[model samples]
Target: SDKPNTIETDDSRLDRIEEMITNPNERIRTLENIIINQKPDILNLKIKNRVHERKFWRVSQILGRSSQTMATKVVGSYANDLKNSKIQEKHEVLVKKKRLLEGSMVTTPVPTQKAVTAFYAYMSKSENIPGTHHTLIFDTAITNENNGYHPFSGIFIAPEKGIYVFSFSIRLECHSYGPYELVKNSQVVGVVFSDIRQVCLQDQITGTMVITANKGDDIYVRTHATTSHIGLIPSDDNGRSSFAGWLILN
Candidate 1:
């Protein structure tokens, strides 16, 4: 009963069925041209016949595997590697403080209060040309909470193109110069000065450094001080200091 509806492929009925299923559009037209251009000799080519037989044998073997133990093993190993790759280690930083008791150890944290008293020269330019001035200054003075001094100053440069050598100075009234760090796009590029100096009484200190910049690149400086009178002036005399350099191809 199952063999009663078997369709034979070698008959002309198969050809009629193929013609009925074919479309008369560009794809069919292109295929017809190919079939006509490569006729009986093309259909009888040795390489094509061998390739077709090999492909059929390969498909038969794949179907005979019935779930394929080797294939399942390989796929399972790949999945295991992917699952193991997602495993991660976690860590925590201690933020609590401690105090000493008569006979026991007490843990506590000191309260932290931070406020920005003054900020100067916090400027940004969308159109930054070579040798142009892009200045950032902190002009406000802050009162120390519990006589604690904290002052910071720097210039941030976002340039379009060219090399730049930037130099500036900070002047504070009471705090000692703690540290000066140069960062390019949040990355530490240079440590201009790391030692403490008497920047309060001197009224001025100059810093000079060089850096290469590309299009849309930025450069800036920052500081930590004890007093509020600290300011980063780009020049010695009211933005008189020049940070000049050239843009070159690396």
Candidate 2:
């Protein structure tokens, strides 16, 4: 019995050994296959980590750009508000200045003249009356307003441009005869004859005329050209030689 048991045990052990030898390194090969199957998972994990890092970096860049943009907008809004406030202050100042100017005096143009050519003149002496176109001078200006009639020069210069009325009276002794003419700008305007012949014996004659005179025209009284004028013009008690003029708008 002991012999049989020992032979059976040896056979069984030999058979088991032979089976293990035939399928060599089975456990080690199974472990190697499992490691190979897990290779894709490991690679995927590494790729996921890289993607998360890139996503984190992109989010950080966006936040930095957003912060800078927000700061710039704030500064721009503040600048705009300051500029608008300054403009409003300037407008208010301008309005105040305008009000002050309105309260001040409204300045006007300088004054002007309306009357200048009203005058009268007369001779204050007895004068001999005989000449050829002799200018008779009235040395005294009674009412020479603007002195348009120069009493010394015996010339009435028109003070303003318009029509003017002029008149003159001349005296002569009896039997003295001559034609006195009012000369205007080298032209005879009118005539008055004072011939105190024995027929009428007039002491004086008067001449009146109207003329459109410029501002600087000349007017005077004179004897007619080369006429027989011989007399003493007695101006003391007999009569007076007078010249007067006034203006009328044309």
Candidate 3:
């Protein structure tokens, strides 16, 4: 009986060992099936990652192009502005130079054939009455070309279109007062004042102008309306009052 019981126990142990081996083989097969089922999901995740990477690369390329376009526009605008500024500066310089040329006082050449010159001096006390425009009559003529100056009318007519230099001087005796105007074609171009109210004996005034005159224009010296009595101080030498002019250029 002891021998039989020992053999039964040995057979049961072998059966248990075989059952353990079978269970382990079944579990390994289930694990393999699970790995096989997860392969599609892994493949789908890889595809999504690739698509995301492509989209990111495309966005980067578009942003780079946009940045370049903006930079180009900025550069172009700056260049245009700089060019316009330089042009404006040049225009201003030209305008300034033109103004300076116009205002310059350089003398110009005069033609010999059409020479216009005149000089006259007053020898007597010729009075300018009140409320009347008095034209200063110069009696003694030092030089007169073509008789352009009328001593009787105290008017000098321009013989040609040209620039001219004109000058005049007057001496006032006691109690004399006047305002003198150099008239050009009925328009006043220059003025001189002689007032001996503060002074006890006399006063003197002089006027000079550079003018542009057209042909047939009349130039003269006349007394203002408010003047009571304006006259040249009587002198034997005719040196107290004088008028002179000369042509500068055509």
Candidate 4:
């Protein structure tokens, strides 16, 4: 009886041990299954997060481009406004000057005889020379009052303050080219050029301008410094090359 009781106790303890081990093994298998079933959901969540991040960056880039475009438009509008303001200011100044001149003309008396008016000149001979800033001499005089035009020096001294109409004509000889400028008080006022490189005989160029002059202002034509070739064709009777001017208003 004592042996049987000991054997029964040992069997009970072994049964308890086996139950504990089996229970833990079943729990572990269930947990592993749960984790395996959730793998697709976890991957989906990660993909969604990456897509949202890309969309955020794309929206940020669009907003940045829009901001830059708006800034450029603002700058352009401001520049246009500034240019218009400057133009308006210039127009207002010119209007004021015109009004002042009109008032002065009303107070001034009209003279019976005009001021020093008649002056004209022309070149009579052909010339072919290369020079820098060389003055052109006009040997033929059509009408010169008060000896205002000096033929030797190729300069015209204004006799009185007035508005004058000036004209110049230049003829280039065959295979030659010349560029000339009309100068007033050492300032360039107009330009004339002639090129006979492609022509069989000659090529002519003419320029004219109306300018206001002060007394003693030096006016003349000179060969341009940048011109490569120099030759002028002139005829005494044909007046192919000439420089002439006359007073128009006082």
Q: List the residue pairs that clash in candidate 2.
A: none
lDDT of 3 by residue, 1-250 (tens): 6999999999999999999999999999999899899999999999999999999999989998998998899889999999999999999999999877765633443435755455565535544443336777766676777677877777889887888889888767777777887889888899888777666685568899999999899998877745555444444444467788888788
What ordering of candidates by lDDT runs from best to worst?
A: 2, 4, 3, 1
Q: lDDT by residue for model 4 over 1-250, one digit each (tens)?
A: 6999999999999999999999999999999999999999999999999999999999989989998999899999999999999999999999999998998888985667755666777777776574778888887788888778887777889898899888888766667776789999879998877677676685678899889999999999888856655454555555457888888787
Best by TM-score: 2
Stretches of model 1 off by over 4 angstroms after superposition? 1-157, 194-200, 224-250
> What is candidate 1's lDDT per residue for 1-250, written digit by digit as tens?
6454554534568888677777456688999888898887776797798999999999989876955877798899988877666542111111122223422343444556543221123222211121212323333223222221112333333334444555544443333333444556666565444223443443445576667766555556554322222223333333332222233322
TM-score of each: 0.28, 0.53, 0.49, 0.52
Off by over 4 Å in 4: 1-110, 236-239
lDDT of 4 at 237: 57
Q: What 10-residue stretch in candidate 4 is worst by lDDT?
A: 230-239
**Candidate 4: clashing pairs of residues:** none
Query: In angstroms, how far off is 223's CA in candidate 1?
Result: 1.8
Instruction: Give candidate 2 regions above 4 Å deviation.
Output: 1-113, 199-202
Best by lDDT: 2
Which candidate, 1 or 4, would have the higher lDDT against the true structure?
Answer: 4
